[model samples]
Structure formats: C-alpha cells, structure tokens
Target: MKLARIYNVQFGKRIVTVKPDWLRVKAPQWERVGNVKEILRDLTLNTVCEEASCPNIGECFKAGTATFLIMGPACTRACPYCDIDFEKKPKALDPTEPARLAEAVRRLKLNHVVITSVNRDDLPDGGASQFIRCVEAVRTISPQTTIEVLIPDLCGHWEALELIVQGQPEVLNHNTETVPRLYRRVRPQGNYERTMELLQRSRQIAPWIYTKSGIMVGLGETNEEVRQVMRDLRAVDCDILTIGQYLQPSQKHLKVDDFITPEQFAAWKAFGEELGFLQVVSSPLTRSSYHAEEVRGLMERYPRQKVIN
Candidate 1:
C-alpha cells in the first residue's frame, strides 16, 4: 500500500530534501542481526522496527533487541503522518500472539524488551488484553527481562488502562506525536487532551513505574510550541521525554515542514532538561521507543514528585 509519498519532493531548480546528513546511519553488521530476524519470522511476529521503517532497526536488531509490534501490522486510525496501515476493519486479534512473543523473548534472551501494538478501537478494551498477556508471558518466560509497554490512549477505556497498569510494566509510554495545534491534521482521530490524560493517569496509577512521552519535529510546529509540549509533559510528572526530527514515512503522507538541524535538537534537549525531565533524548533518529532501555533509567536517578498511593 502507498501509505505515504511525502518523504521528499522536487522543486523546479532545487530538489527538496527531508533527511539531513546527520540522520544517515551506517549498515549494521553482526551475527545477532540474522538471529533476531530469523526468530521474528519463525514465530510470525511483527515489530515496529520493520513496520514503522525505523532507521535504527539495523542497529537495534544487531544488538539482539527489537520493539515488538503486537495486535497487527494494521492500525484503526489513519494518522497521515504514520507508516502503519489505515484499516477500518482489521483482522481479529490472535489469541496465541502473547505466548509466541514470550517464547521469542526467551529464545533471544533479551534483558530489556519493548512491547507495542497497533490501535484496536474495534475491541471494547482497545487491545489491552493482548498487552496484559504479552507482559505476563514475558515475566513467566524471562523473569529477569525488563518489559516496557508503548501503549495508546486505549480509545478512552479507563478500565482497559487500569488492566495494563496492573500488569506492572517497567515503563509505560504514550507518545503525543505532535503539538496540540497539529493534532487535528497530524492525528485526526487522536486528542491532545486525551494524550495528556493518559500520561497523567499512568503516573497516578503506577507512581513507581516511569511514565514517558515522545514528539516529532518538522511537522509545521514552531520551537516555542515544542517547548510548551515539554512543559505540558513535565506537568503530568512525566519522567522521560524523547524529541526527534520527523522524517515523513512516505511521499503520500504529511509533507515535511522542515529538516530540523542537529544543533536545534541539542538546544531542545537542554531546554527539556531545564524543564525538569529526568532524561531528554533529542536527536534525528530518536523514535518514541528508541534506546528505551537506557532512557528508562532516568526515573531511578530522579525521584517522583507525586504522592504515591
């Protein structure tokens, strides 16, 4: 499917470029890369590494770690900026996905595993059951592994949110993706307030667990708007924040507003730290779950401000 065709474009005299030199990564080499691929394929599992076309897949897979994409390769909402498919009627959830995922984790012997899924709005619980099962399976098979859940807003299902929180994930992340002004065009089915509510509720439900959020630049948002988002995240007691330069997935998706410079990313990092975030990962290739294992450690160094129940 032609999900997007807006990564780059050509002008009369100048060829517009969305990717900068700093965003380029070298080819990954190592035996683990093949091993990781073989396991994922054998089990018929999906990973955001491939689905979202992450630039760091080669590096991450080479290191024997991948962010598993559960539920499906299809999402309920068709966010123009995203690479995932826009399926109004996706296939039913696979009941055995959790077990297969757990087995793969055990086989891969990953110390830190990240589990994320496509939106399942058709389901009453917004696919939280699959998340719970995957978490439990990972705990059972590899008790030592740290499980981080990159979740959605659960389509406003509070009970479903509670279930996932009860699963006791090491890190709970719900990416805001973009600033409030761009929410309608960037994520039409998503609400900025709902995103805030998810992070706030997560912090309240599981004070010990690190709460994280992420955003992408070059979506027609100004620097001040980005700073405002960082402040908003901090207000909810968010511990970790990730900011990356948005590279339009395909030519059909949202057009790149501008290619943000590395210097700008560094400046944002400094500003985010000043806002009280434990760790601010700001770079070109910094996707929501990128280097998640290391980012989660910030919570340990920075204590929570919330009054724990």
Candidate 2:
C-alpha cells in the first residue's frame, strides 16, 4: 500500500496531518451500528468503541460486536495517548452492571465477547470482583459465549490477577501500549516490568487461559524496539499480539511520531509468528480487541486443558 504523503488536516482547533489513505476506513452500515448502539443504551452499558473513539468502531458495531468497557468509563490514570476520560475519584461500582452486560450479550447473541474496563485504581482489588461477577453473569445468561477480558495491571496485585485468572475467561489481554524506552512519555502511569509480570503470572496462575498483549506504533519507537517488546511478551509466553498505528486522539494528546507502513506491519506479523505467537493481528488499524471473536477458531485449533485449581 502506497502511503499518502502528508496532508494538513483539521482536528478541532488544531491542524494535524491526516492519516494515510491505507488507514482510511470505509463508512459502515449506520443502521447496523445503530442497532448495536441501541442495545448498549438500553442496557446502560459503555463500550471502548465509543469511549476511546476507536477508528474501527463503525465496522465493529456494524458487525454486531463491541468491546464492553465495564466498571466505569472514567480511568484513574491519565495516559495521554488514550482518549478515555480520567477521574481521581470515580463513582462507586454499580452492582447491577454485570447483569445488564450479560443481558446485552444475550441480546446480541454473541458467540464471543470482550469485557474490558477503565483503570479502577481506587478499588483495592482493582475491580477484580466486578470482573468475576461479570464473567459469571455472562456464563449464566449466555453459556455458550466465549469470554475475553482485557484488563489493567491492577497495581501489580498478583492476588487480584490470580482471582481474575481463576475466573477462567478464554483469554486475558493487557496492552503493553508502547516500547519500554517510551514508557515514561507514552505511558507515564504504567510500568513496563509490571505489565510483563502480570502476563507472566496470568499464565502461571492458569495456563489454560490464553495470555494476550498489544502495542501501538507511531510513538517514535524503532522497529527494533518493537521487536524487543514482542520478544519480552513471548518470554512471558503470550499467546496473542496486536500491533497498530497510533492515531492522536486530540491536540492535547501525544503527537504521532511516524506513520507506520502496511509493509512494516506485515513484516512484524511475520516476525511475531516466527517468534511463536499463536496469533498476531498487525495492521495500521488494528486494536487490542479488534476481531476478538476470531479467537474462538484459534481456541479450536489450539485446544488447552482447563486447569483445576
């Protein structure tokens, strides 16, 4: 794919360069999107698709899929690269959220679902109890639906992580977000070592649950740096990886250091596969939970024995 040269674009009051043609997303069926949104609204649920302003929201919603953002939309940490709102003292957890989320899953008839959350650092267990409740609710309402939880580091609370692992979601994902070198700049509140330890411990706690992590490019990290992150993830036996170009969410957020090419993404995909990642989704528009439903097929191919703890 030929990269479209720099073109001045208007983002609110700021003039930033527009994304290349290869990154452009075709309009989705709004009617389908509306149907999904209606279901979410009826349940009073929030999705990362709308919260984080994901570029692929339309496509995902049109396809009757969404990454459910649980807990609350307000994150405790303010990662500039992210668009999710931050709140020092977010409202208390709603006990009814789990049932409502399950109802949405049953209504959508989802074969697979991704349940993620904001960084509820205020919670002692980093909202692990809520995650467990949500998973149980989904299993009750939609027994056949496979579940994936993209969670936070839980302030390096291994016990909390073990609790989530014991819940036995088909997959557990935590995004590395960027290379270690740029951690302070890109993810000031996140710890590189903590992220790796979390994934490593997830596998240790429950090997049957697939461990997944993601990284975003265009944040001024070198290709070698990205490969290093991949190697680190593999060191923890991460099963799935996602690499995507970082599009600045707003003028106040971090600027895009570079626009990675599709060729480079393809190269990274090849590299990740060579390093033994069971699945690697690499593209300019890829996100952590993008096409998460496909994991059901992966599960069938690489079946795992559920560990009884």
Highest lDDT scorer: 2
Taking all chains together, the TM-score of candidate 1 against the true structure is 0.91
**Residue-by-residue lDDT tens digits, candidate 1, 1-309:** 001223555788555664557788988885778889999999999999999888898899988889999998888888898898875468898989999999999998888899999998889999999999999999999998888999989988889999999898878999999999999999999999999999999878888778889998888888889999999999999888998878777667887877777788889999988988888899878998888878435545665554434
Alpha carbon lDDT at 20, candidate 1:
59
The positional error of residue 295 in candidate 1, measured at the CA in angstroms, is 4.0
TM-score to native of every candidate shown: 0.91, 0.97
Which residue pairs come into collision in candidate 2? none
* lDDT values, one for every candidate: 0.86, 0.93
Native RMSD of candidate 2 (Å): 1.8
Q: How good is model 2 by TM-score?
A: 0.97
Note the clash tally of each candidate. Answer: 11, 0
